[model samples]
Target: MLLNGLKVVEFASYIAAPGAAGILADWGAQVIKVERPGGDAMRHVFADAKSELSGNPTFEMDNRGKRSVVLDISKPRGREALARLAAKADVFLTNVRASSLKKSGLDEPTLRKANPRLIYAMVTGYGLEGTEAETPGFDVTAFWARAGVAMMTTPKGHDPFLLRTGVGDHTTSLATVSAILAAVYEREHTGVGRLVQTSLLATGVYTVGSDLAVQLRFGRLASNKPRTAPFDPVANFYRSADDRWFVVNPRGGAVDWPVLTKVAGRPELTEDERFRTSRSRKDNSALLVAELDAAFGAMAFDEIARRLNEADLAWAPAQTPAEVAADPQLRAAGALVEVDDGSGRAHLSPAAPAVFPGLDPGVLPPCPALGRDTRKVLEEAGFSAADIEAMYDEGAAA
Candidate 1:
């Protein structure tokens, strides 16, 4: 594996930081997840939801293949144990607030002072230096809402909706992973570690950067329109005869207009004055969309798919979760893999995003039970048996 022998000590909960660490673990890093006594709150994310079960795929996806060590960092002993872990770790990852980290003596200065070569990767809702640096933020609030993604994504005149779970966190996870790897490379030359920081808000802004860039440059942006009334009729979703929806993206404008019209069985319409040119189409996009909708609604999904293919029009079906799960392309690409639950049961889970050409990403191990590796991790950190016992007795270690 590319990151073989790399050691990461993760002090984070929920998705962002832990998700980044999970990717490092997939690439062959030994990751030790430092959890509170009751473990990450994500452990109970599905507790009150439908399909309640002892095992949670949500928690597993971000924590797989990592060892969990329970510690109450508010306690002096627990803070001491974490400091010891950071002293030996090649990388220290955390999503804990900057103020809390500083108060607990786990800030970058303290950790980097002990291990100058450590890569300190910090994930936050806002950032480390702002007034809201210590403000608690979740992906939905910071990433989606505060970052303008929610407003930008909501259709004009429609109420805002919640983002899908962990979408922003996972996106930020990719960013953090990239930053950590860069810092790791830099450390090889500088012989010193660096503080790499990323935030959900920042990641969200970047995710919607294309539109945001336009808004910034032009000082204005058109509100997001409904699919049926998009800025470009060629870039919209339409339903087939059987109610299967698919989107077309005629990005080449004039070149694709004819092809798209032909695919919709309306080649004659392309010659019409109101729809002949891109400008005219945009001016009357709603009417064009209505015409395409009627045409597509009269064709079966297979016929529409075949016609689109024949015309070389760019399009994709709006797949459901079930359809996505059965997609052959995803299966062949290793987008998902079977993971053991440690109790001998195996279930399919998402694989790391990147694939190394010559290395196996490795089978994902089960998410550890809370405090599962507390004793072992402490021992490996050079704590004596007596010391470990005393910490446990003091409720500092579990």
Candidate 2:
């Protein structure tokens, strides 16, 4: 319960913004999710999938342990209720477009006017000041397509593929959390909250900063090559006799060359002119990769693993999701946790990417049903029951 006393008012939908608040909730923050009537668009994602599953784990992952209050800020009463909630909150988070938020009087200036100590955090696709600032963007467009990730990741001459669901959004979510916490810390001294902004484009750029750095320095970057003709043959995947795949990344220079050569049962390769140095290996990568492929393919994965372990080589299996799900190390690393969904049951879900030794967040409460806490939250914000009922009657608050 590290953030036990913190209050986060989340006015966001989908992943990035809501996901940030989710991590805070995991650490014991009291999060109030202010959804528009009908709930977040994420609630319909599973329905769009046409799946037979009874639950929406994807939406639940980012919305768990929160109280929901439906409010249509397009109406005057809804905006009044939201402003009152913000007046007493520690943080206000959203991904609504800047123009729209300003129009609704929920922008930083408007909200901060009522509560100088409210932390206003926002997530955007491109950024806040660009010409396309108001342009609607999703992770696929801003993070992957516009940020050079898709180009750099796709192999030369290969068709580009979509990024796995929520990869970029969740990465942006973590960045937003980091920014929000930093602002929270700053508030301790300033006695005032600050505006914290994070964007998909920026996160995507940072994600591939190393590659971008090379491109920046050289004005160009080498296109990705297929595994067979990888730029570095020593760092490549190979198949075993049983057809299992594993990747190896041996040490640079001649340090691990002799060991690798011996382990491959081809000690002469260390002395071979084409494979003598790192540069030469790169120059003749395809040939070296072929040799390694043959050598590894001659032995079963178990035997290959033993030799690699004996040599202290760096290698790992290309594990499938099912394998990773059942991996004992995943639990040991605290990468997953069981969440109580208030259905008299607990389900396994991925944990936030960090751990506080003593502040362990064991089992979390369920994500609230849409508008389940509207009356309670409104009353906590100091609204009278009659006032809350009036707003509900007017379709302002539900």
Candidate 3:
């Protein structure tokens, strides 16, 4: 609850920007999720299970634990209202395009002038001055496909594949939060705000650091399969008889090497020239893996699991989402939480992900429906009831 006193104003819609605000809210920031008069377009992204056209889990996921303010910032009065909110904010953020930011006067120069102590965080597909700046980009198009994600995920000659959800958007949002926190820390002493920016494309490229470095220096990178073996010999994922997967990287000082040797039942492997030293194992990784396959494949999953555990080698059965949801260790640690809404106790998926001193960061409320706090925020901002009504009449109350 250290963030209990932090104030955040968000001009965000989908997961990339609003999702970051949601995490801040979970840490106890008073995050105000701002949107257009009708609502964020993402509010209609996915219909609920009940009606194929009604519920939107997307909006619920990103805007949780925040107040909603409907102000049509495209309008002159709406822009003025939003600017007023920004002036008093500690952190202001948006995924809106650079052009939109300039048009609405929320660009760095304007916003910074309004609040010198405010941290301005911007999320976008491309950096502000790039040639691709004007093109619209989503997580899938900009981060996954155009970037090397499709290449990294699929084999050398296979068709490209997209991830099922917004991996890049969510990841970049967390990065943006870190940037904001750094700026906030600086502001505590200097009282000067700074602009922080991130892009899905850049983050995607940064993700493959080793590959990028290799390509940059050598002009190209060899695909995994083309280099002989894709698996890392003894350190990659392996499926057991029960379909449970286990991954381990046990070569270095594998004092537990005997455990693996015992599990392998190939006691001769210790003396085999191909498996003698770590360097030899890596060089002949493919051959060593074939030997392991022959050994482990002969045993039952339970037998092998028991042996691995007894051997004191690091190993675990593959767990699915359902299995992880019910994991005793995570539950005992209170990593998951159930919070109460006004109607019922709803299980909120995580926003803030770490624990401190055996305590959760904080509790997060469910996302507010659009405009749910318009009147209240207006009142807090000293807008008279008549003024609020007039603004609504003028199509400025989004």
Candidate 4:
């Protein structure tokens, strides 16, 4: 138990914030997630319609190994109870907006005064200051839409795809984790803690830092790697005769053109200067793509992949979510975990991405029912039974 003596209180939901807490849970931290009486909204997003316990797959994977307490902090006493928990916590993390923090009295200064050693982490939409700071945000709203990601990803004539899952949320979550770990490391020398923060928009911007720099430094959107810059005949996905897909990115230099031409049964193309070099091919990429497409159209995807593999060409079959779940490499690596799923049934899901040898890389707790750990958490906090009852009567706790 690496975190046997450490206690973490996470007042976050969805992807970005809870992701940091999930890391701690993986490392054996005694983490208690603070949710509202009805539970965090994420818990209900992907739940099976007929089974309440099904919860969101995103939440289940991110929140494993952490206990939950559904306490409303809307009232004075509720906030006071939360403060008490903070006083005992080694770390405090929240994804609520800055204004909301001030409103709830859970801001960093307030929590630091209660526990100087606390590693305070805050996650926001646009960051601590900006017009959008106080504005409401979601993963798509803050990360993909507002952060210039959509523009870069969208093909010229297509509606940009906002990722189906938590791309920015999970990315920013790793940022938060990196910050928290640094703060914890610094505590060893300073014997004090500091506030660490990250935002979905900020993280997305960082992910595309190189492109942003080019645009800012040169006053031009990138035209060197423009989408119209024809796809390399050898370095692209192709649909086979059977309508199955395979990506083949063999060596892209002129020297490697012979390898692909041989596969296409058109060795004469290697001698044609129009398709000889990469630069010339770029001038006629459509022709090259059409030629390769025709060649692939004559074979099954599996057969194409095999021939390309034997020819030392890099190739792989396009896989779906179901195929990904059963990937042989992933299974051998124990990256997917099996859970009872609280339905007298079992389901396998992806586990945390990294692992430490000799440590239990397992889920310590499953997603909880609303208020599932309310009584237990209160008792642990030294609240008497009558006092707890009084709190319920006052509508401060659930």
Candidate 5:
């Protein structure tokens, strides 16, 4: 409830921008989500030719605890309503392409003229100024592919793979949220709002910043190798006798090398000339990995875990999604939450990332049905009941 009085008017669909607004909503902002008549396409992501699905967790994750208003912005009436909402809102968030926004008179200049205190936040694919400024882009295309994240992450010889769903969008969402908060803070002193912007491409570049820094400095970079052929044998994954895969990353330097060898019951390997130093181990990583693989393959995960812990080495099991869901650590850290659906049913969902020490963001409300708050929002925006009805009748509002 930290943002209890904050009002965010969100004119975005899909993940990144909406996700930033969703976090604001979770923190008790009154978020009004504007959608087209058909609703956000995310609402039907799980649909098939046979039947539309009953539940959409993907949409719910980024849209819960917000009000939905369907508006056909192409219509003057709907655009006027949105402008009215912006005049009163503390923040206006959108991912709509620049050209369309300008054509509809919903651009930053127009909105800010009516409300100088409005924090206009925009999320884009490339950026606000570029040849592809208006290009349609998803996180996969903009963040993963065009930003070089996919290229650097994929194994050298294997075909590039897709990122897990919402990975890049959620990252960009966090960035957008941070920028919005910074602008909000500045507005307090200046009494003027500013245009805050983030893009999937920029966020992706920052995500791999360390690697990109190396590429910039060296003018070249090493490709990601397969797990079995990593650059660091000490920081590699192996399977145990029980077939549980786990990764180990000992501390930097050669201090833990001999300790690892002894822990694997291959103490004699500590003196092996080929594996004596860090450089030697990396140069002969394949051979060292094969040796460790054989040793780990002979032990159950429990034994391996015990030995690794006793040796003070850093390691963790490579668990599946199901395992992660049941992980006690996730709950202990408050990463998981139960949201109250309208029917009073509590369904598990991920909590917003940050945790304020003293304030508790209470139980989150369910995602609103499409156009659920259209009439209410319009009435609050000062439209008469007759005007609201006319808009609905004319298909300007739903």
Candidate 6:
């Protein structure tokens, strides 16, 4: 309820922009999603997939609790309607390309001119000012590949794999939300809104910033390796007797090596010459890893977990999706909530990351059907019934 009275008009599809607005809505903002006629491309994105589902969970995740309006912005009347919406919104959010936005008169300058106090937030694949500003980019190309994350994450000789859906977009959503809130705060003092922007590429770069920073200063980075032969053997995964994998992150400066050796029931190994110093252990990483593999493989997961905890080692099991879904810690932390899908069916849904103390993060409504609020939104924007009818009849509004 922190942003109870805030109004956001979102002109974006897919994940990034709408995801950001979804968080705003979670915090009690009234969000109006402006989609093109036939609705956002996301509506049909998974249509060809073979699955038994009543609704698109992906679409619902980013668009729930928001009103949807369909308008063909290419038409003058539709563009006029969008401008009217922007004029009354505290924030106008979009992921539409800069070129298209300008062409349709929905760019920052135009919208800000209409409402000086509006926060004009733009999400893009690249950025607003560049040769590729208008270039269409999805999270795969811009966020993963172009940002160097794909190359960095790919094994030394393996083909780069695509990221899971919305990973980058969701990350960028957090960045956009932070920027929007800051801009909102600034507007209180300046009495004017500003153009705030972020890009998938930029967000990706920041996500891998520590790795990229090392590469930038050192001129090169260690090649990606298989999990079994990671650069730091102490920071690696091992399988238990039960065949469950878990990761260990030993403390820096060789502080945890002796403790971990004892926990693995191989304290004698600490006296070995090849594993005495940090540099020596790294030099004999393969041998050290082999020993660790055998040691962990001999113990059941429960025993390994108990020993790791007893030794105060930082480690966690590599949980599967099913395991994650049943994690009591996640539930206690409010990572998921039950939401009604408008069919009187309550489904478990992901909750926004932020937690405001003393405030209930209210349940979200289901994603609206295509053009579900077109006429109502137009009416609220001060359009007369006759005007709304004419716009619909002229193929401008749906």
RMSD each, Å: 1.3, 1.2, 2.9, 2.8, 1.4, 1.2
Model 6, range 78-144, lDDT digits (tens) per residue? 9999999999999999998887899999988988888999999999999978788888989999999
Please give, for residues 316-398, the per-residue lDDT of candidate 5 as tens digits: 99999999999999977889778877788988898888888787656679999999999999999999999999899889999
Question: What C-alpha lDDT does candidate 1 achieve relative to the native structure?
Answer: 0.91
Using lDDT as the measure, the top candidate is 5
lDDT tens per residue, model 2, 291-337: 99899889999998999999999999989999889999888888998
* Predicted structure 6, TM vs. truth: 0.97
Best of the two (4, 6) by lDDT = 6
Residue-level error in angstroms, candidate 2, position 157: 1.3
Q: Please give each candidate's TM-score.
A: 0.97, 0.97, 0.89, 0.90, 0.97, 0.97
Residue 375 lDDT in model 3? 80
- Model 4 C-alpha lDDT versus the unseen true structure: 0.78
Q: lDDT per residue, candidate 3, 175-289, as tens digits? A: 7888899989999899899999888888788776678788889998876542224434656556666656676556566465555777768878876888777677777877877
lDDT values, one for every candidate: 0.91, 0.91, 0.77, 0.78, 0.92, 0.91
RMSD of 3: 2.9
Question: Please, what are the lDDT tens digits per residue for candidate 1 over residues 22-114?
Answer: 999877899999999888999988778876356788999888889999999989999999999999999999999887899999999999889
Number of clashes recorded per candidate:
0, 0, 3, 0, 0, 0
By lDDT rank, best first, the candidates go 5, 2, 1, 6, 4, 3
Evaluated at residue 207, the lDDT of candidate 4 is 82
The stretch of ten residues in a row with the least summed lDDT in candidate 3 is: 224-233
Reference-based TM-score, model 2: 0.97
Residue 350 error, candidate 5, Å = 1.4
